[model samples]
Target: MTGAADAGAPLLEVRGVGKSYGSVSALRGVTASVAAGEVLCVLGDNGAGKSTLIKILAGAHAPTEGTLLAHGVERQFASPRDALALGIATVYQDLALVPLLPVWRNFFLGAEITVGRGPFRRLDVAAMRRATRDDLALMGITLRDVDQPIGTLSGGERQAVAIARAVHFGAGLVILDEPTSALGVSQAALVLRYIARARDRGIGIVFITHNPHHAWAVGDRFLVLRRGTSLGEFGRDEISLEALTGLMAGGAELDALGPELDRAASARDPA
Candidate 1:
């Protein structure tokens, strides 16, 4: 496992990071940082380059420009395994889980616990179940059965399991890609609570979402993006939920359309 980062340096830092594909640029000069025990929320609309940023951070793609620093030292990730080796884990919207597999199975999918030697080696089912239950409990998730199919759990519960798996395996930084996008209010709140729980445990998180309310609920800092460019990075005290919402919805553009919208409304009502 990687050691603690230098004091005052973020666990992960992107300095002027940019990505391009021949004639097109997917990201440009975007910068952000996530420190231990901090939640850095990345907010943006559909085409705001959030996916692109996640890919770069996850080592699925290389940036065309700028530097990525882990533990205050500059480095480039060759693949997802490289990022994983540095204790960086990403949980995307699809979750990469098998619907038929039990909760504990999915929790230790790629990294399973085993016992014995050579040909006698076998999966430690009991140990995995115990650890899965204990880890999820640490995140305030109490499952009735870790043996149930993962698909049997609610959306929020599945997300919580993914997070617990990352934390259990020593992930220092976790990048969550729209984990609560498709859930209802109560379900979304459950995931947000888990996020806070992870933060309290001193894990760095990059939470990507389009919802300002969700972001504000667990974020220590906010980074707003639009059309592949970064608007700015703000601390919790530096920005309000309202301002963040306005930015996500294009405040200037909305202001320009307000008069036209009012005219249209009056014409339709004529009252």
Candidate 2:
């Protein structure tokens, strides 16, 4: 059995993973990998199997075919908690934070820190607040006070909080789904900066998004999907932003439509 002590092993591995619901197949033979301090960005349009793959990884659903490996050992998670216990934390676009709750409280919502070594245990509010502030700052997030409600923060700040929460809970692999989809350009860049900060801390990240631009920015590896199957995978050294975007949208299709699109635009503009 491969344990967490295996330094050379990948943090998570999806080998030939597939899922189906009745006659509808959601995924097909998807194989991907992530290691410490790396970002594996998964790109695809809606209904292209991104959520299905996340479900499998998040332990919300089991793959009908293929295997999930953690640290080189087969792992079949019966529930999301099982995945969490194995140091895998998934943060979706709709973050789970209770908007009205204080930032520190939300940070330690489910897993609260306690004082007293023995039976006189008590909730450690001061410690949690201090820790939350420090952790958030580690990701370049600053808050005026830890006692403020989480809802008062901006979208980017909330995303950073979720990330910091995950890391604080001992997660080694952080799977983020569409983190920057709803943000403006500057906010998206803020999230990307935090992603890089996470990488610097040696946590492997699986970033799932439909935005080719965001994926190409901080991603170390890229996996593009179409029709529920990966079109291809590319390393940082293998592709640039322009090429990656072209391929993500089907390069051949883009090329074939270029002249026609240009003609249509010219006709409309009379220029």
Candidate 3:
């Protein structure tokens, strides 16, 4: 949707990354990189290794082969906390929010700010409330009240809050796993707008989704995977929307669907 990234170094890079479980290969020799202010959309159908890729990037799993580089240096992330320490944040579709908690409370759920010292410390509720309000406002997300239960918000709004929270917590790379999958068309558009807002603020985004149209709407680069392997990765200029869709469905597979659909249409003709 925007111009290519500034040609700066990637904030995160995966070089020939692979993961395996016993004899089952979940990911094989996949490679991609995302620079600051860029959106790299990873598109694939089920069993395409997208989940494995997310776990590796989020440090939930370690790669059995190849390398992961952060800011051009090779490093291993032993846990999710290890990756978070380096400003890598992953926002799953469920959002990991407590539906019963107020927006402000949920905003600072695990990482609450505190006042006073030692045994006298107390939750800085007012500070968190204001921060939650103002920060979401800056991300173009205007909530009616920070006191409302987060579950009352629509799917898109909840995802926006998660994205804003990640950015506020100083995450440089935000990985969104199917953030728009459950939303209707209008709500999905709202989430896409939030994603663009994140990119404009100099955050690298790895947007993983099965919908090529959703990914195509905001992606600057595209990566396709099939059956646990990397089909290819292409820049925005190098790939078209049609080509992206075809590749995600597998070129030959979609071609086979065309004639069957044409025959189905003819069978329904009154003439």
Candidate 4:
């Protein structure tokens, strides 16, 4: 494996990635690339290898076969922490917020700020609150206050907070798994707005979702997966929403279903 700053580098690239469990193939020869400040959306139906692809990228599981290049260097991450250290962070659907904890506390949970002298060092509550408030506001998420419990925030707000937290923590590449899957239409829209905000901040994002509409809303590039393989990948310029939806749901099969149904109806007509 090469370092992340090698030649012909993409901000993040997975070439010919494959994953298998015993005799089951979870992924097969999937390849994709995401550049800086771009949103690469991976769209797939349930069991279409989306999770497998994400795990590989997050370094949760090494691809049975493939090369992962970050910042142009080939690298293999031994664990999720390894990936995070390289500035890659993953936000799963759960949001991973401690519901009982205060918003500010959850924001700075593992990486708390401290200040004061020597043994007197104490949690920098004021600094963390002010920063969290500002960061969330910058991402278009307004909180009543940072002292409230995280569970009080809407799903979209929670997701936005997670995104802001990742960006503030120096994540160069953020992989989001179904960030909007559990939200309603308007709530999902709010989360999507924050995703765009993150991209505007120059952090490359990999958005994994089953909703083509949501994917199209924030995606600069699209990769459609099916049956553990890539159906295709297209730039926004190369594909439309209708085309993408058709592909994900089996275009040829859909086309054939209509005509076959029409033929059956004609045969049943009495002259």
TM-score of each: 0.94, 0.91, 0.93, 0.91
Q: Write the per-residue lDDT of candidate 2 for residues 35-102, one digit (tens) a residue.
A: 99999999988888899999899999999999999877788999999989888999999889999999
For model 2, name the residue pairs that clash. none
Steric overlap count per candidate: 0, 0, 0, 3
Model 1 TM-score (2 dp): 0.94
Which predicted model would earn the best TM-score? 1
Between candidates 3 and 4, the one scoring higher on TM-score is: 3
Model 4 residue 32 lDDT score: 90
lDDT of 4 by residue, 141-231 (tens): 8887899999999889999989888888878889999999999999999999999998998889999999999999999999999999998
| lDDT value for model 1 | 0.93
Give me the overall lDDT of model 2. Answer: 0.90
Clashing pairs in 1: none
Each model's lDDT: 0.93, 0.90, 0.91, 0.91
Residue 229's lDDT in candidate 3? 96
TM-score, prediction 2: 0.91
Off by over 4 Å in 3: 1-8, 261-271
Q: Summarize candidate 3's per-residue lDDT along 1-271 as a digit string, tens digits.
A: 1133234658889999999999888999999998899999999999999999999999999999999987666769999888887788999988989998999999999999999998999999899999999989977988778999999988899999999999889899999999988899999999999999889989999999999999999999999999999998999999999999999999898798999988888889765
Clashing pairs in 4: 3-73, 4-73, 9-72
Q: Give the alpha carbon lDDT tens digit for every residue of 5-71 in model 1.
A: 5667898899999899998998899999999999999999998999999999999999999999988
